[model samples]
Target chain A: METIVLGIGETLVRDDRHWASWANWLGVPAHTLSALVGAAVAQGRDATDALRVLRPGMDVDEAYLARAAAGRGEHLDESDLYPDVRPALAELRAAGIRVVVAGNGTVRAGERLRALDLPADLVVTSDEWGVRKPDPAFFARVVEVSGAKPGATLYVGDHPADDLFPAAAAGLRTAHLRRGPYGHWWAEHPDVVGTADFRVNALPELVGVVGGSPARPGAEPHSARPAFEDGTGAVGGARPARVSYLRGL
Target chain B: METIVLGIGETLVRDDRHWASWANWLGVPAHTLSALVGAAVAQGRDATDALRVLRPGMDVDEAYLARAAAGRGEHLDESDLYPDVRPALAELRAAGIRVVVAGNGTVRAGERLRALDLPADLVVTSDEWGVRKPDPAFFARVVEVSGAKPGATLYVGDHPADDLFPAAAAGLRTAHLRRGPYGHWWAEHPDVVGTADFRVNALPELVGVVGGSPARPGAEPHSARPAFEDGTGAVGGARPARVSYLRGL
Candidate 1:
């Protein structure tokens, strides 16, 4: 089966502004907070590192941090998706593609995913795995959990170094979701942009990039290899068994 | 009238690869040629300037250049538009919006427009105007030709300084079409991205950004000030005469 492992967080949710909002709430300069968060993300560090760096000398409050994280979660749950996200995810799922959300997201993001009822087979976050992206082990774990060979898998994300390069290095087809903070950063480097197998602005455009899903009724035929068999042993030959797991990575 | 002036070249067609193809045909490195072309475009120069730079010391063959240009035109004529472009243009025109194509494109591009029979009230090009975008007079000419008040018009383009900044400076609502070479470049700078009233990845998303055409059946109501007065006379009390231009700008 063709598995698509998406680096969720900002790829699916509008989480870039969360850092700025949290900074504003905590009386920190938004730009300073954004830069610190950006630096942490670029280094493949977790959100905790960002918080620690932003509040170095201050008495950090765990409960207040939890509340702030929850606030970000609520913001995400309140329909903060890009316009093409919902329909594209629906179409991909309906077409029988195994969609997974793998990222360096906070625990609250996973909670928000459940609250929003997002469609995906598995969601693996750094909070659960203790390893963030740009780490080869993280992508390997995602491929293993998704039951897809790196060659057959498609890993979509916004970051060039943190997401695209590492995923590409791991042998998965990489797509650059050009929208968020990292996306803007990636755009500046032509060499990085050239590395992505596909660079799309909207999520729905992936339907065209990945080829149309066969299970979608009345969907136009695409040049992409079929995701599954047509039962007559013509197109894909045979339908692969569905891979499912209930535990976090 | 609400006029939408689109930066036609790559915004409406796929013209990037053609440059590389032409460069290869002329025995020049694609990257070197691309950089030279980019430099010219960054200064708001036209296709002719790019050509002059590309073939600086060469024995220029006018016939060969014309044939190559025509080849590019034919490539464009073969439905080289983005997936969302056609439907979006049709819907906008059906809604009685005056659409115009304004850009720093070659004369062959204008011919391709005629061949494709694209829906537009006027088609303007640097080839005809003797000036390119980011030049205040070029935008002024567009405003004068379209009979559109700058505030009421929407200028959609892919470039930051070349397209978005100049149009915005002229007091037009600007939309950054986040595709093509310049789109990727513009996304890198937050300051430039912030200048655009709308930053869209897909052309169909414009139906949402620009209020959906009232003529489209089952269109949702939007909060934008109505482009024209309704019979109820509550919003936009009096309807203005539609500006119709039969000739090219």
Candidate 2:
């Protein structure tokens, strides 16, 4: 059974409005703050600098940021779940797959997931881990806690650099959830899309990619997997000579 | 034969880097110009205002803007064609589909399409039409020139408001080419996706929706078409009584 670790922001929840809400609460122009965050994401850079650039003169402390985010999280309605999320998670869990919610967000994000009655086996956040994603340590913790083989496990996320690339680098099969800020930013970027093992427009589309019966027709199967790899094609079976030569070496 | 009118900008060509290049030539920050264009796109607003916002104080004349855009267009290399483009167009044309290229770009965009040797029967641009997309007249003209019925003709584009929505409103089947600026931006917005008659990631995917042996296995046949519609499914066959009643009325 493959363990599936899912990233929450923009993957499970539509929390883009929260960015603007947080900016409004902090007295920053909503568009300016959103654009800054977008710019950072587009450049594959951390948003810490972009957030700091929002209030150049003011000394915005960590506590203030946390409280503001929590306040915005509180405003998230049940409708925030992408139309396909709940059903997809339910379907994955029903298939006996362990689904986990791990996101680079505050603890409130975890609380919100629980509040929404999402069917995940576990929920983890950067706030609890004391480290954000794209940091190898965070992915290491996720792999450790999930107890799934790094190569066989799957990490589904919306961000190319933060979620897909790092997860792929950590030896996890990566699914790029092409819906949200990073999804929109990276769709045109072939280099980023190349790093993804699977690319899906909706959550339910993952059911097929994860070795179950695909709910959508014509869903591309593990496209990034090489033709010689198992389950991809018969190219691997024809390489007996190469295998024997390698064994002799 | 189904007439396919395709939008050119990010659909057939990658023109994003040109925005930054033009900005660089104009002595403005690249990020600022790109962000302005992105912001305008996200809001479904015309980029004219965003371009004007780039040079607030300067007396930037129309000739300078045209020259700068032309210079940037000149930098576009053969590599700008998405890997799947040429083959997909060839396949569609071979299948007897009348493929047309129409985009919201300067006249140089049309020349670039010709230079790439895209197998488009007719190429049109907003500059030549004296109108831009999302305007009903532009689509009306495309239908007139192509000699295809509004209901059967397919207009493929990336922008939601500028391409898909207006084409849908104009009674043409709309395929939201899920690449480029709008593909990512609107992927999360369900309301926009609803307007598209077909949503596909690659240009080759369009071959399946346009009526051919689908290149991809399990490809949905015109997934956006309503269940009762003919050519999509047999559900319309089950509605004989309703059809008879409507005919009597």
Candidate 3:
């Protein structure tokens, strides 16, 4: 049997305006953070500054801040997520996957995930692990926890530096969610295995990368290969066992 | 001197794909078009076979011809555009501010404008049309066309029909590019001003929506009334003409 794949990220509850969660203030459509981020990126700014410019008028959650402080390093907080992501998470977990939350402020992210009432095999916080992604040791934690080899695991995420690069460096196959309106530096990254817009909007899509899934109701499984691969190489092939924790969604 | 806006579209430049143009083909970032189209709207078919899903060995482009031909009736030919676009032709001859081709198909989109090359003010094409924004008309074509009726002229494009409907139908303002991506059916009628997006991409963006030299770059003599009521319920004030046609990267 193949080892299961997992996902990690905050499950903020809200609408597109949820970017304002940190400030506790909502902006109109014309001034939403996504729009600002898009404008700033179009003007050629880096991600950190782009995030700064895109700051919401809201305040950061106390729990989110505490988790970041405990990590003792430069990292974004849990408030980064848009709301309404829990359903996506629950669906993945019910499919019997191992989910390891790895951000510094991930406790807040985890709380939100649990609030959504999803099941997971594991939830790893960088505060407890003392290591974060882009650091192979962080992934090593995944190997240690899940009993899966580095090459056998596939990491799927939206961040390029923190998620994709390190995942690739560690020899694990990687797929990028490419969520939100803006594309990241990893958009051009060669190792990006696949991309999903809104349809295959969750981590299970990568299951197809490791091994194609059986068709679901009203939905056909997609191949894990890159959409543009012109016979250069094939991606992951191990069919990980489904984690039943995510099936309800 | 009111600024001029030129809207352009591709009547035809075959690309053997179910989609209409290269920018759209490129903009989609290589994914399953069928999956992107979503199942709720896909009826109960076991599979959707757009250009994105040809088998690994098949010539993907060739595989889409049958499907594309089936939808060809929904498209308008290049000759059909010249009539409604006449006002823009006159503006170009008068050496107005800029010519904006909002949809994709940039390569062929400019052919119509450049063929005349009648001392154009500027050019904006979807390839370089800045954000390919669904609104602001990529600079409001009808306002540019009528010259004296900025408030009365209706603007139209294919996508985002809802966002544009209120302004046009209420006699406030209007524009319609076409009908598919942004403005699916279930949207209200001629509330749309005119239809474009002839091939798929925002043609105006391809031809020249953002750059080239202004008709008179530095000295923009504002000799016109406000284009609209600013929709802010504010009284009269001189609304500065947007410097959309100036050269940009």
Q: Backbone collision count in every prediction?
A: 0, 4, 61
Better of 1 and 2 by TM-score: 2
Model 3 scores a C-alpha lDDT of 0.36
Off by over 4 Å in 3: A1-5, A9-17, A22-31, A39-48, A54-105, A127-137, A182-223, A226-228, A235-249, B1-249
**Candidate 2 lDDT, tens digit per residue, A1-249?**
378899977787765456656566655434445555554444444554445544444444563567666764345557777778888889988877889888887676667767777888888788888999879999998889777787668788877667876787787877777566556445434444445666676788777777642212233364232222234332212222211211111
TM (chain A) per model: 0.71, 0.78, 0.56
Local error of candidate 2 at residue B51 (angstroms): 3.3
What residue runs in model 1 are displaced by over 4 Å at the alpha carbon? A1-249, B28-75, B212-249
- For model 3, residues B1-249, the per-residue Cα lDDT tens digits are 233333342112221133323214333322122222221122212122222222224454354454356553223344334233545434434444333333443443455545644344444454454433334554443344444454423233433322343223323232333323222221222222121111112323222321232112132212211122224322222322212111111
Tell how far residue A66 is off in model 3, in angstroms.
13
DockQ of 1: 0.02
Q: Which digits, one per residue and each the tens of the lDDT, describe model 3 over residues A1-249?
A: 134434454222212223333222322121223323333332334322323432323233453455347663223333333433444445555555554444433454455544544445555566567776557788777667755665555565655445655665665545555543222322433333332211223444554544543222333336432533334333333222222111110
TM-score of predicted structure 2, chain A: 0.78
Clashes of 1: 0
User: How do the residues B198-249 of candidate 2 rate in per-residue lDDT, one tens digit apiece?
Assistant: 6677788787788732212234454332222234433212212212211111
Interface RMSD of each: 15.6, 12.2, 14.4
